[model samples]
Target: MTTRAWVLHPDIQTNRDRKDPQPALEEAMALAHALPGLEVVGGEVVRLPKAHPGQLFGSGKLEELRQRLTDQEIGLVLIDGPVSPVQQRNLEKAWKTKLLDRTGLILEIFSDRARTREGVLQVEMAALSYQRTRLVRAWTHLERQRGGLGFVGGPGETQIEADRRAIDEQLTRLRRQLAKVVKTRELHRAARAKVPFPIIALVGYTNAGKSTLFNRLTGADVMAKDMLFATLDPTMRAVDLPSGRRVILSDTVGFISSLPTQLVAAFRATLEEVLAADLILHVRDISHDETEAQDADVRRILSDLGVDENTRVIEVWNKVDLLAEEEQLALIRQAERREDVVVVSALTGLGVEALLAEAEHTLDEVRMRKELILSFSSGKQRAWLYDQGVVEAEQQTDDGFVVTVNWTQGQARQFHEL
Candidate 1:
């Protein structure tokens, strides 16, 4: 059964957040909808001079919201920001409804969407960490008496301490399991590194249409949806560029503003793909009202993930089909003035070819022209050059072949190794 929920974005007047409150509320509602069994019936931006540390609202406003929740029969209330454990318990008790803060709601969505074993384990670890923080006075049995003589004080572990210890032990086990999984992933990455194909990774805010673009470019049937966090596990496919050069394209989990710290730490392994990428496409929904903000958030997360400044990045202005014709034309013209930006519509296939052409050109810029002379005895190396399609021209000589090729430094190093 769907749980009826009300989403609220607290617009604290004294807060320094520059995001417009209405859009934040809408995003919160979208997050609620993203969860499989949540029915977000309503949402609103509640303005306050400041948040009360205990209940997060003034006494009168708290009572009013409590009455409203009761009258509307809302089973869950989602606050689109941080809520202390004490505040959460107090509000839940006063309103008689289950409460979920932004982090908790996002965790729930991730728990539902995670598919791969690694992703599932990461979500479990993050969820456990979040739950650990909420363990204060949350259960009725927290004070239950342990086995001991009535005349003497109880000697067994306190419930909260026991719960924390259990979580810690489980976390240790998960870390061990995660280490094995990460080792396997590292081996896979090493194998791919030997393939001599540059990796291009797609990154964007949630629902910005990265999967659609990935499917269109690679012809892979990855799930593409309008829902936030439609794809959680990292997916990769080999794509042949317009110039006949093949590259690996990776689609990663989308970023969101104020992403949970726990998730960021947990999903580091998955994001290593982006870190290793030869090029990154920062896709954006140009038609969205908060596109710039979303772009900033994505960039912030990328920096936090330790993506180097030297890594090549291209800005992909996506969802042009959602814009008016004139607006689309203007955007295209604007993009044309920039070297690192491409305007595209993944759904309509508009400018997709241009995108591919630009990607190929950008990648080619990193290659250096080199001439090599190989003897007939170097047949294996000669065949490898031909297989990679990097040899621009070859000429027969007295006892060898002179080969002219354009290749990246890594490819040159691999050739030397051969």
Candidate 2:
């Protein structure tokens, strides 16, 4: 199959700070490069001087784009901006090509890349939810069954009704399946409570070098790339700290501005991976111009997810290699004043050891301290306590064993129950 795309964007008079159309065009090309069958013919940034409620851009611009589309022989229209369902349908009709918004493009990339069952389910759920809202006409062919299997574009007797019904059914089943995944994840969380190792989740804008850091620390080759959303499914690996203690380090889906709401809801199962984390490492591109704003956006998202409170979040200024020595020094000075923030270059491995040591120290510090005294004869019980919680400070007396255990509040209760 030959794949070609035309890019479109509608920007208001304000919000000039929106990502340059070039990166989005570059993103489209990058995705096309990753997917073998894809070919990007050409792309243009059509600025809408005034918004058209129905079409998003003026009819005159649409006419010019249609001529360009015909001349270029483009098969797909990729909109770099958000579009209403009505606008999407109208644009497809007007342009006479398959139209995809930024959301749809992301979903397509995710659909192709998802490997694990949970990953596939999450992508399918997002696609289904997005498709449900759009309800584009030609998409009906995607649903029909013939010869015991549905060919995506095969002509069918009962096309519309069969496809819609099947989509609905698949959606229902997908929801249930996702619920089971969520339940299994919750069970895993409970198991983690049995041994409270502090979790550190790496979250940042896609292509900000999260997977590289994950591989460097954990020795797991999880598709490290310089492209966007390289790792859709959350991958966790045990990171052995310098003290021989291990903690769960999760490489989660990278964040971006204007993430589709459907995608957010659909990937809740995967996102719960972050919720269980005891600490969050907000890796960022320090050299990027939008670093602070991107940081703000990430914080806003974490707050929306209700993971902000009491979470030991450390802002890691990653990719400092892109900066000069003076700039690096300035960033380090800035980091010194900011609590729970550090500067490090994941690419060159600069300051990574210090970052890890600081993370472990912070993890050790925030734990709830408890005072538990047990008789010396309570050998098994004492051993259980020792196994369950971290002994911050211990003193074995002749009459008994007096120990101060540093654990989460939940673990403290378990100790008392023992």
TM-score of each: 0.87, 0.81
Question: What clash count goes with each model?
Answer: 0, 0
lDDT string, candidate 2, 70-165, tens digits: 888888888876788889888889989888888888888888889878888988988987877775455435355343344655455455455667
lDDT of each: 0.91, 0.77
TM-score of 2: 0.81
Candidate 1 lDDT, tens digit per residue, 173-274?
Answer: 999999999999988986776677988999999999999999999999999999999999999999999988899999999999999999999999999999
Which sections of candidate 2 miss by over 4 Å? Answer: 14-36, 136-165, 370-387, 390-405, 409-418
Tell me the lDDT of candidate 1: 0.91
Error of 2 at 13 (Å): 3.4
Model 2 / residue 186 / CA error / Å: 2.7
lDDT of 1 at 237: 96
